[model samples]
Target: MRFASIGSGSRGNGTLVQDGDTCVLVDLGFTIRETEKRLARLELAASAITAILVTHEHIDHLNGVGPFARKYSLPVYMTPGTYNREKIGLMPALELINCHQSFAINGFTVVPVPVPHDAKEPCQYLISSGSSTFGILTDLGHITPHVAEQYSRCDGLLLECNHDPDMLAEGPYPYPLKVRVGGDHGHLSNSQAAGLLSQIELSRLQHLIIAHISEENNSIEIVRKEILATLGEWQGYLTIADQGTGFGWITLN
Candidate 1:
């Protein structure tokens, strides 16, 4: 299995996961043209995607899903609560998923784990192909015990290290907006993400991708410090998914 991201940040987000002949997109936030260009950078054609799995209804994650799916004639899967029929317009193929259940999409087994985000029915994904498990975890505020347990044995993980508490506290956002962002239902702070890294089985992980960073409230230096502080001597590969152009494909063997 291999996974790559087109972009990841507050402005937009999209990730591509491929296993054999099946390639799926977790979310598409860029415009149709932007998505196409980004895919080309990954040496992929837009038509190569077999489906799209939406996590929530946030514009940064849902903006291009509708148009992209319609253009490519791809199947889309998401929890009913996350689906906005009117907002998304018409779909070529729609599959309503139960957040609590696991479903098969060709060669992959997708497990939708519900997360604590302010969106209607947000959920991250754990995709398994044979013995290789790759997890796409982002947008959640805090790590739940259930989430921790479910992600305990991932081979590759794309984790959200959204912001630094100190930076967020002093940033330009208004008080209420700051409160909401730092709240229990908002994005995870750098320390919170480090806390999750510590709790998981770090030995089994091959790739640790820091994702969903806030452009204004966080920086590469801050996230680096937290990750280094938590990783200690662990020698797994580490890369930050960029908002402009996300990192290249990392395969799990």
Candidate 2:
């Protein structure tokens, strides 16, 4: 299995997970043209996407899902709550997923684990092809036991390091916005993300890609230092998913 991030930030977010000929996109947040361009950067065409799995109704994750799915004739999967709340118009093939169940598309097995984001029926994904598992956990406030258990054994992990607690406390966002971000239903801080690593089985982890970093409220150095502190001397391929050039494809054997 192999995976690449299309982008990751407050502006937009998308990820490409591939196994052989099957490629799936998770949350297309850019416009149709922009998504096409980003895909082109990865040497992929929109038609190459076998399916789109939506996490929530936030614009940063749902903006281009409707148009892109319609244009490419791709199948889309999401919880009923997310579909009803977003009102994503019409789709060529729409599949309503239960957040508590596991489903298969092409060669990938997808496990939708519900998360505590402030959206209607939010969930992150754990995808696997045979024995290799790739898990993506982002846009959630606190990590629940179920989430920790589900993501503990991934071969590759795209974990969200959304902010630094001290930075977010004194950052530019207004008080209420700050409270929301730091609340139980908002994004995770560097410490919170690191805390999750304690629950994860590092021996099985081959790739650790830090994602959804806030450009304004956090810096690369801070996030890197925080995560490194938690990881200690564990040697694995560590990377950061950028907003502009989201990192190249990473293959897990």
Candidate 3:
């Protein structure tokens, strides 16, 4: 299986995953034209995507999902609550998903895990095929036991280290907004993400992509340093997903 991201941050987020003949896109925060351009950068065409899986109803995550899905005639999957708030005219095909249930589409098994986030119905995804498992954990305010357990064994993990607590505290965001970001239903701090990595099985974890970083409150250097310190002696591939242009394809064999 192989996966890549167009970009990942508060401004926008989109991830492309492919296994054999099945190609799926998770989240769409860019405009249709922008998404096409990003896809081209990765040598992909928009029409190749078979489905779109939405994480929540947040504009940064759903902004382009409906438009792109409808344009491409791709099936979209999301929670019922999320569907309620979405503009139905945007998506050509829509599928309501249960947060705790597992569904199969185009030969890939998708398991949605509920998350603590300030959204109508937010969830993270765990995608698996015959050979590999990929986990996408972003937009969550705090890590739940269920989430940690489900994501522990993934072969490739895209984790959210939204911001550095110290930096966030001193950043320009107003009092309430800052509190919300650092709260239980906000976003994960760098330390929190690093700490979670320590508990997971790193032996089989081939790739660790730190994603959803706050441009105003965090830096790649800070996140890397924290993760390295938390990793102790374990050695693994690490990359940070950027907002302008996210890292390229990561293939797990």
Better of 1 and 2 by TM-score: 2
| Candidate of highest lDDT | 2
Q: TM-scores, in order shown?
A: 0.98, 0.99, 0.98
Off by over 4 Å in 2: none
Give me candidate 2's TM-score against the actual structure.
0.99
By summed lDDT, which 10 consecutive residues of candidate 2 come out lowest?
40-49
> Using lDDT as the measure, what is the rank order of every candidate, best first?
2, 1, 3
lDDT score for candidate 1 against the true structure: 0.93
Instruction: Residues 14-48, candidate 3: write the lDDT tens digits.
Output: 99999888999999999999999999999998878
Ranked candidates (TM-score, high to low):
2, 1, 3
Error of 1 at 28 (Å): 0.4
Candidate 1 C-alpha lDDT tens digits along 1-253: 9999999988999999998889999999999999999999999988789999999999889999999999999999999898853379888999999999999999999999999998999999999999999999899989999999999899999999998988999999999989888989999999999999899998989999999999989999989998989999887899999999998999987
RMSD of 1: 0.9
RMSD of 2: 0.7
